[model samples]
Target chain A: MTEFQAGPLSLSFGRKQVLHEVRTEVLRGGTMTALLGPNGSGKSTFLRAVAGVIRANGPIMLDGMNLARMSVQEKARYCAYMPQLLPPPVRMSVVEVVLLSLRLGGNYVGASAAMERVDAVLASLGIMHLADAMMGELSGGQRQMIGLAQALVRSPKLLLLDEPLSALDPRYQFIVMDALKRETVLRNMVTLVVLHDPAVALRQVDSAMMLRTGRVIASGVVEDIVTPEIMAEAYGVRARIERGSDGAAMVSVEGVV
Target chain B: MKERSNTESVQRALLCRRLLIIALLLSGLIAAVLWNLVCGASHLPLDLLLKALFSGPDDHLEGSAGVILWQLRLPMVLMSAVTGLSLGLAGAEMQTVLDNPLASPFTLGLSAASAFGASLAIILGLYIPGLPSEWSIAGNAFLFSIGSAFLLEMVVRLRGASAETVILFGIAMVFAFQAMVSMLQFVASEDSLQDLVFWTMGSVTRADWTKLTLLSSVFSAVMIWSFRDSLPLTALRFGDDRAAGLGVDVRRVRLAALIRISLLAALAVAFSGTIGFVGLVAPHIARRLVGEDHRLYLPAAALSGGIILCLACLAARTLVPGEVLPVGIMTALVGVPFFLGIVLRREKTE
Candidate 1:
């Protein structure tokens, strides 16, 4: 499998440094890593840096290739990032959106092959039926699925998703996470997802990276890093982890610290 | 068996829709040309008009009908068609680039800048000495239009290019040049003022073979260029962030589109004066008929623009019989009401 490392990364907006010396690593393929942090903790900034949407100090290494030096088109080939808020929807079909994403990544499969790929991605996400629907009429959760379909169609080696489940209900969150896991494993891709719910992260992800105030607080096994003491420190809440009915770790916040 | 037939039926239906639109536009273009020829100040019947068109060169034509068709009507009809096609194509790209439905050369102040330039030529007699006096107005208008585009480019470079920024600057440019044009109007002699007013109102009477050849050649080049870049332009419709994520160089594509848009608008305005409404209205009509696919949108927009201008020319000539109202006035009279209806209908739906 591949290995991805982002080390000593620093980013600033004007004079205020948002991310400083943040370092994280994950299996470069066949895994989903949950990025855990409180709000305003530079989680989004760090993801943007890795996606090459913004400049950052230090190299983002994907299979030993430095992402900082890669052109936008080249980086797009290896990495795809879905932002938290999609742009206002245009009157385009779902399949057209996916096909556009493929075209943008310089993947020039002929029209029929491109449509085939769109169908495949939509089918994989169970959105095949909505392929002909207009994007403007879709609900937020459905749009999120379309966003994911767009990202997945590119077949990126590294997929960065920013708050992808924020708009989804319980059922879609699980479906989307399970699909991400399956696709990541199937394609040998490194799927880095930003998730706020630690309990959901515990159930869905193989590894976790926790950041607080522009720094990485912990990076390792989910159980070891998501302790009550660490939660209280990072999230400023007194919390405890307990086994749920499904035998997976769940975080329950007792009160504000 | 069922699925195959279903797919075939869908394909056939789509092909029919495309062909129908194409046929309608072709017929409309032909009808507009013939109507424009027959309905001028001196009405030539359909048969005489056909004979005039088919008759030998101007030197060998039998009578005044041939003389009128060859001399007065032919160039005017061609100019109306060319100006509409250019402005419509430019408007389609402008709306895509700015992400605003109402944007066009007229809205963006390029036309106003060209008017200001022409006013300087007509009112102040300020023109380059080397060129003939006849060409000074068109040449100056062309230069100032390019200047307006350059000003836009500067703004984009200074404050990172965005749709809102481009539109805001364009509106500002429009007001600035309008004020300048008004000031020129204030200072002009009565004769020159009338000339300036008529030029601003727009007319195709200035058309000649030389100007038509130049405008058509430029229009053809830009159309081919836009057609080639239709894919990237379609990507831009989703917005800058999405386009960039898809690996499009958003700044580069927008800048290129703006440059070509400036050239197209400049050439149309320089030759035919500041003809408004066709650029703004045609693209909206086209989008309604063909959806947002740029490949279809561009051609449909071009045809719609041509149809509107041709009809405007027809009305300008025949509305009062002998005295001709400016085509620009007729377009605004027709366009504003139609635009309001579109807006009101949209509001009701929403």
Candidate 2:
């Protein structure tokens, strides 16, 4: 079984401690977890820490291998992180960039199938028509999808994303999250995506990891944790959670939270 | 989709550019040779110029076309090509490596340091005049020119620097080197003043075969050795954090490119005395024509810079009909309007 666990990771930037002792574990072939939090709640910082894009002190282990000890090339084979902001001025065609993300020779996972898998991913995202386009000329949402697709090209065991749905409209939001959720389970990979809203993920993700003030406020099955009381306390406003009569998992926030 | 076509167009343009660059380079060789042999103050026709070229060394027509072709004109054309190509490649690489289009060797204080080195050589050097028709000096001006390049680079990479801050640091280095040169100039002797003025004006009239070959080899080695890193430099354009996520060794690439470009700029400046604008203008033109991919930009910029200098030299030597002007002044004068138009029309500050 694949298990990625981070133990009490701590980091500070200059004078401010952005992420306190935060801890979470994502099980392989099990759950698509969302890092849920309000703005400035250290969710982004924690996601970055999980990806090891910057230096921090803590125990972050993947399949019992200590991430802090692994070389960058070693880590690259199993993990990929998509930052919150992506610049598209690289003068790369979408196809060329797709080629860039494929492992040079082989990988820890399904390296040989990367090109076919990525082509399908582009089609599923409705960007297959843009396969020959430059990333620089795409709409904001299209570019974001391409950026997400590039990170997934290596078929990484762990995928980390930050605020991928913020500026996106509701339709794109549903399309992106659903695709990611479906792909994670199909590939049996662990996904950690940071999202501001959970409306689109009601029927998609299997689990949720909520953060408040740099600490894990809750972590469990999606239905059990995304409650009215907890979310109200988390976002510091009122909210309502009533289960659907048909046994479907859905939560609605009619009030501020 | 618009996206598909834009990318396809960019790709097609690059392929066409590669072919065009090859053609231009092939013609550049023939042009360099032709310009050197013909079109001098004495204006030898091709028939005599060919004879001057085919005949053995130290032989000439009564008009002494050999002295014009073999002794003076040949070396000058060779060095100008070398210097222009080196500066163009260095500037383009620097901007691409830093992911900052505004960065150039000249704006980053390389020229100032080279001028300082040349000034120092002029003011204080042991002169020899009898051993073998000698005008050699004790000054190892070449070595000092490299030292100043290192100093300017170190300042740019100091503890905290964004790309703009780095350019500002280079500007400071220029002012500092300029002050040093001013001090040296104040101490220079009357007899050597004329020599300093001629050297600083950046004329290729004193160019020779020996100097051309040496400069050509060194500059070519620098560009060729650094070519492998061009893609990684493009990968850098995706932003530092994303590149690091892709396992890029960002520090190593930055350091190697900087050191190599430093040598290229210093050597060219030492040879030609701080010719400006080729470093700035050639890369700007290359980006407009070929896009920002360094794998294509570097070689194209080198070719363009060479052709531009060759044409500028032709104009400089022929404009007045009686007196030959320095090539540097023409490059500066011509480059200014083109640069201004690009800058004025450019949509982004980059």
| DockQ of each candidate relative to the true complex | 0.42, 0.35
lDDT of 1 at B262: 80
- TM-score of model 2 (CA atoms): 0.81
* Segments in model 1 whose C-alpha atoms lie over 4 Å from true places: A224-227, A230-235, A253-257, B1-16, B55-59, B121-172, B341-350
Candidate 1 chain B lDDT trough over 10 residues, lowest sum? B1-10
Q: Which structure among the candidates has the greatest DockQ? A: 1
How would you encode candidate 2's per-residue C-alpha lDDT over B105-134 as one tens digit per residue?
A: 777777777666666655666444453111
| Cα error, candidate 1, residue B158 (Å) | 8.0
lDDT of each: 0.81, 0.71
Q: Give a tens-digit lDDT track for model 1, residues B199-266.
A: 67888877887778878888889888888777778878866665666666777888788878887887
Error of 1 at B53 (Å): 2.8
Instruction: Report the lDDT tens digits of candidate 2 across residue range A1-257.
Output: 67887768888988888777888855666468888877888888898777877777898888888887776666777888887775464565676676566642135235334545656667666777787676778877777788777777777788888878876777777777777877787777888888777543445677787888788888878676677777887887676665688766666667784
